[model samples]
Target: MKRIQFQETGRICQVPINDIFGFMYLATFIYFLPVTGIIFIYIAILKYTKRSLIIANVRQLGLEQTRYRRELRFIKRILILISIIFITGVPYLTFFLQVNIGQSPMPSYGHRISFMFLSCGQGLVMLLAIFYADDVRKSLRNILLQKLPWIRGRRIGNIIS
Candidate 1:
């Protein structure tokens, strides 16, 4: 039998994360594109909502104002979420930019920081979601009730909701 040369199943099976080309293309497609799209969508929403409020008839002014306030709050929450995600992603991006591929050892702080962000960021995001989303909270309560029969508690009003 011919000698089987093996390192991986394929020579190019995995893209090195620090590879400049891989990083650029992946970041462009995954990070920049989605972030820019989200920003544009929020901008459009805000502009359209403002226009609608401005053009509201006297009869519907109160309703429009309520709508405007609700939309504004939603937009604010989204902005917070975006900020959190961005903040969490920064260390990784910084590390990516700081390191030259295969030239020197990658910084240990970069790996640590990225790991911390990845771990804590997910929990923070989930907490934000739980706080903001009434349905998610309700579902979690229901699941807890179903899974743990021993726990007995009266129905409680949702403070956030």
Candidate 2:
């Protein structure tokens, strides 16, 4: 097995990849995990309340209902995506916290699996948004059509038809 040497203590330790990532999980749990959860809650409440306010004012203020609704929906989707990402990271945080506090032994594969899920959460949410939100789908489609020649022709043909 591979090992890392420490000069200060005159000792060499064979730290597995899981142990290395376990430290990262602990660090994230101590530092940013709570912050992420708090921000998720804050944004969720703010967005939904703001959406309600907009709905209440639409009739009296003669706001453009369709535009407001679409914007609100987009905001809601973004909040949901953020919440999902934060939730996915919670298990890793809990596992690391337990290990750090000596409540449980170091997890063999759970840390790596949770880390993978946490890392991919943002990209997964974005992909889901592309399918869930009309605005995102249209924007991505337009960008792809502009940058790729073959896709452009096919998309244009489909649009025309």
Candidate 3:
């Protein structure tokens, strides 16, 4: 049997598959479960309590209402983005738990694809930020146009000059 090497100690430890599964189950139950629960609770508090408070205060701000409303909208967009990230992350977590704790065998391709999906979650958050914020979109457009002038065609050159 091929032994798994420990990276930190550079030691080759012969650990049984069943023991590994038990360790994973305990780790996930003790660590990941509580952490995930806490995050969801925090998000719920932000969405229900803090959001309403901000909206109420923004309403009473009179002259600054427009600015405050815009800021609030941006914050709401960020919250939504966070929620999407958490929702998407559940699948990766589920797959990880199922494979590690449940001792269910996953195909190589399935593992690779699950990892890829998890990696892409951050990219999705960035995309949400870019798409939701007009200021960011404009800034990105300007930077892209400056770096790759050909993207804007002749009209952009004329405008720039």
Candidate 4:
């Protein structure tokens, strides 16, 4: 097997390739398996929701005017979260595979930056969820205003968005 070793700040990281069961192959598969499942489940939910709503003729009810709108908003938020995770994770995947496959040498800082971005992906998702909830967002905004009263007249809500 081809093995790569790199050291930074008194720490060394190694990756081994050249076989189907290599570190790169196994790690990438394990990491991406959940992503694949999330996308699959999202699609299934979208299809089920749309089919059921349409069959029920929600538009004719004269009361559920926001049914599709609400459903789409919920689904769109989920899609955004998934996209954030995948997009942020791509950099590390590329860097790892490129190095392990011998296409390029991994720059010491590249992997670190990629890992930071990947780690922050979940944080971004959490922030999105928190800000999207009406009560939480309002409470947070109020707390911010209370803590920093100078920016009261300005667009504090815009910052949360």
Candidate 5:
């Protein structure tokens, strides 16, 4: 019967510092893994390609310009994956924490806090992934343009001989 507001203006509950810290630390750690994965993916590409990292990176960027429907499909898949991970992990974590850690005398909202942090962390990863994809698309587009300048317009049109 109680409704929790997603945003609020005043203090509603008190939480223990350790629980809060646990939430933040765990969330940040999980978030870092995927980010590290993305970075390593780039590094691996650079090593294998034996090309300028800058050029290679730009080449990847052009994937974004694909028609809108494909982009939307990719975005939907990423979001669904993010949601599934959070929904599955958060409840399991909450149960584990409650069972092992014991609820506070004041009635713990620790799970809620932890979920907030986790969701934020997951959101960060999803957002970064989207940006990385777009960067790859743009970079590829740029590389193509550089290699074939005439795709957009005449090399030297109206002004001279």
Candidate 6:
């Protein structure tokens, strides 16, 4: 995976609690990606520009850098897994892009079955990643707390309280 500078830091400065819950609620009203992007930007601004706000809100919200980082990592893993599924399957999908692939635009029963299986595979991968991610995130959070004093116990319970 490509490593970004901010992600390298053990501190997660991404989506805050309000944004997390907001996204959950927004998902009910809006399609996910756009709402998620807006939420991401909102929290990112607070972390980067509104330092005072974070400091003021941190205590009440019980947000620690460690928890933020853990959530960020979990989000990152899910995105990566989804991306991998998309990229790996792109070639197969390209066949549909053409006007013809020695067949009709309408897919055969076999093709539909294959497509459904592929979709299921992607869904399964995402589901597993979602379940496993919590464990991986907690392990990383603990490691960061133990290894980095400045970050250790700095947040509420090393994750979002």
State which candidate has the highest TM-score: 4
Regions of model 1 farther than 4 Å from truth: 1-18, 57-59, 101-104, 137-159
Per-residue alpha-carbon lDDT of candidate 1 for residues 1-161, written as tens digits (9 for 90 to 100): 22223314223333444566766777699667977887898899889877887777655888888888888988898788778878888887666656664455555455667758956876797799677886886777677768766653544433423
User: What shift in Å separates residue 52 of candidate 5 from its native position after superposition?
Assistant: 30
Q: Can you write out model 6's per-residue Cα lDDT over 1-26, one digit (the tens) per residue?
A: 22222322224332222233553454
lDDT of 2 by residue, 1-161 (tens): 33433323323343323365655665578537865775777677677667767676856554555655666776676677767877877877677666666666655665566667777875787677667866766776777677776765465635522
lDDT of predicted model 1: 0.69
TM-score (C-alpha) between model 6 and the true structure: 0.34
Cα displacement (Å) at residue 114, model 1: 1.2
Ranking by lDDT: 4, 1, 2, 3, 5, 6
In model 5, state the lDDT of residue 141: 63
The best candidate by lDDT is: 4
lDDT by residue for model 5 over 32-119, one digit each (tens)? 4764565566456445444443454566555533433454555465555555455646663665566556753323554566667667
Question: Which residue pairs come into collision in candidate 1?
Answer: none
User: Between which residue pairs do clashes occur in model 2?
Assistant: none
What overall lDDT goes with each candidate model? Answer: 0.69, 0.63, 0.61, 0.74, 0.52, 0.50
Looking at candidate 2, what is the lDDT of residue 116? 75
Residue-by-residue lDDT tens digits, candidate 3, 1-161: 43443423322242323356654665478546855775786567557655666676756667456655665676577667667667666765676677677888744455446546756876887787666667766676688788997778656544432
Model 5 C-alpha RMSD vs. true structure (Å) is 14.5
- TM-score to true structure, per model: 0.66, 0.50, 0.48, 0.70, 0.28, 0.34
Clashes of 3: 0
